[model samples]
Target: MKHAALTGISPAVIAELKNGRARTLELTSAHNIITLTEAAPGECIFVTSVNEEDLSPGDPGIMVDLLALNIGMRRIEVANSFFYEERERMSARIKVQFRGITLTRDVEGRKWGDPTKVEIVRSACYRAG
Candidate 1:
């Protein structure tokens, strides 16, 4: 992630939209410094939001949830984002892969001489039915 932030774009997610409803996961990173969360659920399947950086990738939960939701699904992978907590704002890099496709993005405010706020700068692009 940091590596990509240095060079260019960060990681990202690639897949078709199964269920547009967002599923957030707060997992402590290996260092336990970052607690990722689902960004706000933006527009539905086909449309893009005005604020592209704020769109969520639609995480539906664990395996059980996936089984239930993926009934009529073909390709679905949603983990393209999470908002950082304001208590400790920092840079972020995310990379997600699904069906052999990889997407990534980076949010580096300090590197650009700006205050790192609690926000996500990555955007998820999904193929609509």
Candidate 2:
């Protein structure tokens, strides 16, 4: 029941998230909130624990070692439906430090079972290395 409630996120992923969260909190006092919640029930509604925000619609936010944009340090704003409410809440409720790589919702936040009705975050050729 406990595991089911949290969806398909693996234990290792959870631990990684917890560790990352702790490290982030330790390194800075920013209030930006990028969290994952279950929007669908299922065989594969895996929610990653990353914000997945990027401003450049046509390219990754990486151009140089630095890009000048505002990412949810003080707040995150998105017109993307799934994240709009979440973004708004985070913006109103927290404060943080961020400069470069603005937050723009590139995909639908919800994971409704039907693939045709939903959109996944654009992470196709991107590698995790």
Which candidate ranks first by TM-score, i.e. highest?
Answer: 1
Q: lDDT of model 1 at residue 26?
A: 25
Model 2, 1-129: lDDT tens digits are 111011222345445443323112111112111221222222222222243332122321210111111233344556665555433322212111211221222333233331211222333353232
Per-residue C-alpha lDDT of model 1 across residues 2-98, encoded as one tens digit per residue: 2111111212211221233333222222221111122112211111111223423341211101111111112334453684333433333332222
- TM-score for each predicted model, relative to the true structure: 0.19, 0.18
lDDT of 2 at 54: 26
For candidate 2, list the clashing residue pairs, or say none. 30-96, 31-95, 31-96, 69-100
Candidate 1 residue 117 C-alpha distance from true site, Å: 8.5
Question: After TM-score superposition, what is the CA distance of residue 117 in candidate 2 from its true location, in Å?
Answer: 9.6
**Candidate 1's error at 47, in angstroms?**
19
